[model samples]
Target: MVLNELGARINTALQALSREAVIDERAVDALLREICGALLESDVNVRLVHTLRQNVKKRVDLDELAASSNKRKVVQSAVFDELCRLVDPGVQPWKPQRGKQNVVMFVGLQGSGKTTSCTKLAAYYKRKGLKVGLVCADTFRAGAFDQLKQNASRAHIPYYGSYTEPDPVRIAVDGVAQFRASKFDLIIVDTSGRHKQEAELFAEMEQIAAAIKPHNTIFVMDGTIGQAADAQARAFKQSADIGSIIITKMDGHAKGGGAISAVAATGSPIEFIGTGEHIHDLDAFSARSFVSKMLGLGDIGGLVETVKDMQLEKNEDMMKNLAKGVFTLKDMRDQLQSILKMGPLSKIMGMVPGMSPEMMQGFDADESTRRLRSYMCVFDSMTEAELNSDGKPFENESRLRRVARGSGVRPVEIQALLHQHRQFGQLVKKMGGPKGMLGKMNPAMMQQMAKNPAAAANPANMLKQMGGMGGMQKMIQQMGGMSGVQNMMKQMMGGGGGGGGMQEMMAQMMGGGGGGMQNMMAQMMGGRR
Candidate 1:
């Protein structure tokens, strides 16, 4: 879970007042004070914080509405809306023009993830069914061409670069011409990153941009740079016509606030966010989703859709079964398959509300999947009676050995699977049951839990009161409701959930779950139990 420190603080202040039954002038003032403190702590510009506080105070002062059951919700929604408006102001979504090749040039300083981002962007467009070509024009860096070439091969996109060609401008000009002749729908030029003081290299970038004449120029920056982003953006903006910005490495540090908020301050719209190191780890930027994640409101819609597109119908059906309290080894197999479709487990987990980049960094995706797959194979060898039983039907060691032998796996793998199943079952009971647990979680606490899946299934002391199960139910319903869930399901199913096959096929491929096709079929069947 990427913590939105600034958003979390505002939500916390608002939650304090919601607990009270009566709205007093002093209570509102105190809440505003806390909000101010939180914003400052998050490194939000003092002027922005002051403006936000003034807006909040004005809303509080003008309201004659007494503290009713819904008063807290109303105020909270208002604050959330205002904060979103202040941060994003509802800019039009970015869409690369269709039916023609689009050229995108990446500009940033060294180690800002420009080369990696280029590969990722190519992968992103390739998955969209576009013929993407990569121009590794960053010839100055060691192994820059090799790195980009390797990534392009992995993504199955064409690459153009030369280790021997010392002139980057010539390489870029020729690369674009070659790709154009090949009729590629998109061409990405990965330029050499230099410090702001490198006038020679900056001039080279200008020359390359002019020669290539790219339709879009994206400025990539490390999110951890904080206020330094303003200077970097200014430098890039001055040298070239930068159309958009891509903020990389936002999964760590509190500086995501500074990078994103700085866009508004510096007068540029965010184009994309690099959430991880993988070529498939890029996501389209959405201010609403970003703000919601920051404030501890779980992105239920995003999660469901991401899952639907990446996982097989079998996988999704199995998850829906788990959601409805049905746990089976077949279901477990489907879940593992879904995880595989979703790419790395750690990456998928990071998209959840409270899971931080640090927590995800510790777990190796391949190792976890290998272990889970081994466990599933063990389960496959089980007898029907054992498979359908509530508890381990084969209680004896001899039976475990026989089952493991049949599955050609270790007996310990079976034990591990059982242990995982028990843990997961406990989690489902806590999250789904009326009074099991997760029943008392507040917005901030829920946000934290979203970041930490282990905590998501457990009850916390911070949210012990305030209407318990009923309040949780209301919160869940409000996040997206059943219709929102369905729409997300459609997105996950890719285009197959609606329209014709081509659209559906495109959606499934880009959705990221290896199971897009199967998910489409399941959705067409009405996403039933």
Candidate 2:
């Protein structure tokens, strides 16, 4: 949701076009004007905005699209592609090898979160099974070594830094040699940064590069720097070979269009973006996925990777039960637990088509965390028999009341928890049944589908297996289709809680009364890329 204002304006413009009864050149012009204005206001270069406008106009031919069923969708798709183009450097960033030492050098102006990003990247690679070490060569700034030492210690990553070593070039050389001798696969060298680009900083950077050759040089840029990012990035690019860029403070309320598009214009691919101060908040950057999330459109592949990273697939019992079309209370509890491990609920929930991370806007994240823990407490209060069985064991009113008392929650709250669990259980049963899409396909194929969406490009056949197209249409009609989705987004954008939307959407997908995940997905993908 970085650059949320820009996204909201563009979304509003698109929504207005969708509501229009007529589609013409004038309407198209109006849409582009609104979108272009949003980008310009978000610190994007005027020239880049102009170029995007020209590209959109070229792509969206009203005359050719006149006969199309959905003129709005055509324009929207064109705009989405152009937005992606605006931020894509079109170059692959460097990747670290697992069995060999890979030295990654970090450089940026002071206060750009360069030191923090070093730890973040190191932690990321470490999480992926790499032997990572941190080398603090940032001796120009006072307490730089201590900062790196504290961060590396906190992340449990090995570190090499010297308080007495004033020569950064020598320190960098020694650190890299030591880590390489230690057989660390990924050695991160945190170089010194200055308040501004200067001869001293450039000289130091060059000397360090000469001493300890780095495989990748990452330029860390501050998101709040606006259009100045281009000058900063270009200056650094001139001094050193910037293999990639990482934009920090994207979680703030700053307009990130400048830092993102400006750096991309420099031909330096943005490999990662720092979403928060947390070590795990550094997310791999993907132009298309970034645009999708900005527009509140989900990223299924990203969601799969998150689940995979949490190692949720290691539960053999759950897999076996799922294959047999069984979903016990224990399985639901495990999912909730896995969700907790996945970090904030809003973030993970946004991967669904209709949900946005801002759906819980103005809703305290701690409150959401507390809510999930409360449900876990209810699960813990249950006996082993209740945990292993379906909701049948909790049908007795006394049993439900007793469990609620044990968890210190209201009886109705316990019932609501049970309802949510049962819904999840039912959806899992249908999806993992012998007749279900998951059961019918192998794990490798499912993984392929997640990685390459084109594999499941034609979801009609997949939908038919779950039910029929007619069922899908009927379900969407019941939920009012995009009307319902738009309303939900409006509430979220207004900084209000939109849990009602989530519950209603999930209920429809669960087919607790009607609809199903199959029906919902096909309807959601009707106009999606």
Candidate 3:
């Protein structure tokens, strides 16, 4: 629902195909046709859709997929993988150590959300404990300084700009110097939204880039631009060493697919996405999750981890309740709190499988939160006996009336809550019993499940579920827990796992003994049970 129209079209296309297995070539061909039609309808680049269809056909021909019984699943997986590659070829790492005080410059036309994105990036880095500074070099806009300054103040980062300094290059140079003087770790340069055809303005951008020597140049495009993204990307790339792409206003756009495919076609990786107007609405671009969501194969893992991370203080308690198969209205309230922490419901649910932009079109975050809160109030009005003994409340109409009156909601709404609670309770019971998929999992697997419940719920486990010992260690570090296991893993893995390989490096940082490192090494070799 985050990108409603596109999401709906994609879901409809994927629904036409089965994820089990297909023996008929005709069915596979038909499925490909549907997929192509859907992508085209979503305003995806024509050439890219053709390439995707061809790749899907080629993969099917190679028989590299699952066995006959699992053909559908294999083909679906192939399609998802290919789609992800089409949008983002791979992860674009930002190496702070490789460059001196990484400077990222944001460029876009006016009203494309450049200033807001700069603020979001600053906030994101600040949350990571990095010292960040912002520069408002958009002198062409009358109020650009005040606008960016307000955002910088909100983010609590140092901002450099002068209404009197008419030269953008000088402002940029001074901003960099100021950040350097303050010992900031990251500096972001925000430029005016200039038309690509304006030679004078383009020359100014080049001068600013040269004066400051930014480590990365990001082209911020409005998702509403749709097919125009190709031209915009080409224009920016001509003037600067564009290192990354950011698509803004994604939540309101119907043609975001075009922006994504267009940038990817230009050989630039999408680094981040803006889902809404809020500073916290930006998310790191994840190709796999995007593709999976587009295909309607729920993204349970992301939802779960987001929920867990958002409710750090309540995680252990929530997990215990989950294990006990008890999901009350109170539990639902806690779940709502966790969801709120992650962001809007429609946006969060958009990550779930089968949720389309169309489905999310009219689904507002504030309205959903209001309804959920109302439902909780209705539940709270019920008597203890009515809540503890589920069947008795449902059997008595008088009790329902009492609850409706107490909560100041309609009786029908109260009944609806009861009905929903019953269904949720049943689902929890199933998840906790032996017949439940989660119940059958081992401890290590359970830990993984708990860490990324959203991933676990995904119909296609396309997104990597971050769990196991490594995930646990990361979670611990993130939650301010003990760092022992993280350090041990770093020593064992030698940090070459790249960003992930630092588990063992963390062990050395913790001053652990060599014997402890040996034990961690054993775990890496699958020696530990």
Best by TM-score: 2
Local accuracy by lDDT, each model: 0.63, 0.72, 0.64
Q: TM-score order of candidates, best first?
A: 2, 1, 3
Winner on lDDT (1 vs 3): 3
Over 406-519, each residue of candidate 2 has an lDDT whose tens digit, in order, gives: 999888777766665665566566656666545666665445434543333234434654346565555455446766655644453332231222332332232211122323
Q: Candidate 3: deviation at residue 237, Å?
A: 1.4
Q: Write the per-residue lDDT of candidate 3 for residues 232-349, one digit (tens) a residue.
A: 7788888888888888888746677778765664577888889887777887777776665555544544554443334243244444455456655555545544444556555565
Candidate 1 lDDT by residue in tens digits, 211-324 = 989888888878777666667778878898877778888764565655665665546677778888877677667677666656655443455555544424323433333333
Query: What clash count goes with each model?
Result: 14, 0, 30
Q: Assess candidate 1 and give its TM-score to the true structure.
A: 0.69
Residue pairs that clash (backbone atoms under 3 angstroms), model 2: none
Worst 10 residues of 1 by lDDT: 495-504
* TM-score versus the correct structure, for each prediction: 0.69, 0.81, 0.66
